[model samples]
Target: MELELVRLPNGVRIALDPMPGLATAALGVWQRVGARWEPAELNGVAHLFEHMAFKGAGARDARQFAEAIENAGANMNAATGYERTAYYARTVAEQAPFALDLIADILFEPHWAPDDLEKEKGVVAQERGEAFDAPDDRVFEQHQSALYKDQPLGRPILGTEAALKNVSVDTLINFRAMHMTPERVVVSIAGAFDRDAIIDTATRRFGGLKARPDPEREAARPQTGHASETRKLEQTHLVFSWPSPPAGSDQLYAARMLSEIFGGGMSSRLFQEVRETRGLVYAIDSATDTLEDDGRLSVYAGCSAQHAHEVAEVVRGQLELMAAKGPTEAELKRAKAVTRSSMLMGLEAPSARAEARVSQLFLRDKLTDFAELRARMDAVTCGQVQAIAAKALEGPACAAAIGPKAGHGALEAFGAK
Candidate 1:
């Protein structure tokens, strides 16, 4: 695998990864700005802008845009996240240029039809409602608020109904001009594409934009407390979060190792103990959610209201045990195996590979070799993992729950009032 990189005179970065013998390709334009960069008044304008981009751009209406891609046998989509917004496409290698053109059109030549903003706002309202109605999703949203408190990071990416109502075409246009500059954008393509043509097209399309100062963003301020919502559901959804190393930290590999051993899989501690052994919960898992400036070690479980307290206690016990003594040698070996296999498996897919490239460029400002990643994971010792776990437990944990019990005893178990 070889990666070709180009930095245009205007500060736009283009990365091309050539995968020989593959028939398809995946490519995208990823910007370093997302919900966190949005002003409070425009909280969800980024997401709304993404949805509207497809409605019309260049000389095509929404129908024309859809037909263009379908006619070319290409797929196009976009996503907005906490720290980034991506416009991406996947298609046969032969259609890579057309796919790229479609993406470019949606991005550079957006045509916000007069009625589109209102309709999109209504659509997003439905989206926000659906998310609010799902107990599990609602729990995570509450957990996020607790984790970041009053910070932008705490706010839901799906802008509130009030914020969405405030959005207009001018709002979207202003937000784009502020954050979607050349300096914050990366154009990446992977798979069996004509590298020269792709790079040339990218340069011609993206190079004209003038460079500007990087967008301002608030540093993540992780708070530790409890957030809860009561609802009459069959089972309680509980989430526990602890502060952890941010992205690009040396301790990240160790932190991930700890998560894998703690609850990443069926053979892991939380699953085996909380579910298979004690049968306290039907589902329990742990994951490390890392962003550029902050992260959290989170554990989630679904169980009967009656067993919520017991489940929380068990989870706390397991976390403390992991932090105190680390994983057994067997557990460590298994974690390494799981992590290594997952990395390898992801590398086999063009879309996954493209996403990884974008993430690496954002985090490390360069593509990290696979061998280097594997080496780092292999070098994470039990002591390192233990240190990461113990350090996270030393701080206050954020807890969220939504259900019949409203996390009555669960939050108390984690010492979150």
Candidate 2:
């Protein structure tokens, strides 16, 4: 993939990747501010700010703003993550100007109002409640607390109800003014579009953004633990974590393979041994979360309350076995193929490309195109996988489980014996 990158005098970046015959385009503004950017008092304010951005901006109120884009075709909506907030739009190639204008309006010209804040608080609160009510989601929250301790990274993106109540209009506006600056923003567009026209539109919309320096964000504090609590639920939800490589490191390639082979797919060792073989879990998988300074390779399993202890033991044993013996050459080959297939499939969509581009640039200030990324994956060896598994095992393994079971959600109390 060829990239056309430009930095405006004000420090805002523009990345354009044109797919010649595609009929639609996706453009998004990626900002380097999220829950981690907030202080303890303002736990979920970043997310609230994201909600408020859509409440009103410029002349179009939230309803009109959404209508304009939907009328033009933006089936996909904006999203907020732990490290960034993205406002993106997809529309006909010719509607590029309108889409960018509307998205930029959301990103740069939010109409902060006390009324909107009061109303949106309820919506955000409801969303938070829903997340807490779901056992799968609750398990991850418990896991985050165990893995990140009292740090902001452990704070839920939706934040607590108390935090939302404390957020006033001034806090919202000031936070945006401080973090939503040119130097910390990346504008990315992909699919069929006029490059020159898109550039001019971005400059006009974002050029006036001040190059205000972003304050240094708090680094995520790493943590480890083994604790569980009782919840009157039907099935047990388990989230276990170990050490892994940070983002932008070559070890990430190996980490990806480790995660996949560990418990990723149907044919994975854990899924085969714990589920198909033992009927231990209804759903099980391995996932990784990598930040600039810290990372985790975690496995999640939802099983009958009676089988929680057995599931945990099997998972631990799989890691130990892999570390000692390493993945077979056939397993290594399959992992690489699965990873490549997933990446290639995601590339088929313009929005995916836009998100990938912004993420790479925001995290590392460089985009590793398909060829480079493929080469990295292609270069991973079984030795690296074994070494990663061994090092991961050396770290404290944290376990968090939520369910009403024989042990009342405590996997450790269930007796490893």
Candidate 3:
């Protein structure tokens, strides 16, 4: 893939990942601020701001924003994560400029009317209630809370009901003013498009935006101690988290492979051993979350209340075995192929490319070429995977399980005989 990096005069960074023969284009604006960046009192403001962006901007009202993208024969949406919020639109190559303009308007010119803020507060409150009611979602939040406790990283992106109720137009507007500066944003375009023309458009549209001093953000590094908790539900949701590598670490690549081998797919050890062989779980997986300073390796599983202990044992056993004996050569080969193939398949869509470009630029300040990523995956070895697994899985770890009262005892057995 040919990648171009353009820095506008106003300090906004633009990354273009052009696919030569495609007719579709994906464009998005990515901001570096997210749930983690908010002050404790402003927990979910970043996410609420994301919702408000679609309410109206410039000449486009909410209805107009929807119609304009639909008329262009495209899909438009946005999401907020632990580290960033992204607004994206996908359309034909010819409509790329319009899509870009619409997104820019939404980001820079939200109305944030008082009535709209009141209405959205109710909507977000409902959304928050729904999340709390869902066992899968609620359990993960519990796990995260226990794992990172009292830190910004542990705070829910949706904030509390009281917090959401108190969020006024002034709060959101203040947040936008402080965090949505050119220095903290990246604009990305992917698929068939004229690179020079897109960059020119971006320069004209975004080049004059003012830069602001970035707000002081809390440092997320320095290991927090392990913690755990129990809750009431039908199935037990167990999570194990330990400190790992930050993004761009040499060991980070190996950490990715380790996560895949443990639980990335149906063929992975966790699935094969916990579900297929023992019928202990309906879902099981492991992942690595790499931030700017520190990272975590987490394993999650949902199983029958009666089987929670067995499931935890098997999951822990798999990691212990991998640490002691390393992954087999065949396991390493399959993991690499799975990782590479997943990357290739995901990039086939214009929106995927656009999102990928935005994420790379925001997180790493670089465009990740498919070929280079594949090469890196191809080069991981069993020794490296085992080394990372041992390092990440070592020492006491945190676990949170939400299930029937009967399952409370299972928490005590995690990483235990």
In terms of lDDT, which candidate is strongest? 1
By summed lDDT, the worst window of 10 consecutive residues in model 3 runs over 221-230
TM-score-better candidate, 1 vs 2: 1
Q: After superposition, how far is residue 331 of candidate 3 from its true place, in Å?
A: 0.4
Give a tens-digit lDDT track for model 3, residues 45-146: 888888887787888788987888899998888889878888888889888888888888887777789899878777888998998777777777876776
lDDT values of the candidates?
0.87, 0.83, 0.79
What is residue 235's positional error in candidate 1, in angstroms? Answer: 0.2
Decide which is better by lDDT, 1 or 3: 1
Name the lDDT value of residue 120 in candidate 2: 91
Worst 10 residues of 1 by lDDT: 405-414
Candidate 1 per-residue lDDT, tens place, 267-360, comes to 9999999999998888889999999988889999999888888888888888889888988889999999999999999888889889888888
Off by over 4 Å in 2: 405-410, 413-417
Give the alpha carbon lDDT tens digit for every residue of 1-417 in model 2: 457788899988898888777999888888888888778888899899888867767788878877887898765467787888888878899888778888888766788789879999999989988988998998888778777777888788898888888899989878888997898889999998888888899999989998765678778666657556678887888888888998777799999999999888998999999989999889999988888777888989988788887888788889989999999998889999999999998788898898888877877777667888899999999999999999988776677888875633345732211
Alpha-carbon runs more than 4 Å astray in model 1? none
lDDT of 1 at 151: 79
TM-score, per-candidate, Cα-based: 0.98, 0.95, 0.94
lDDT comparing candidate 3 with the true structure? 0.79
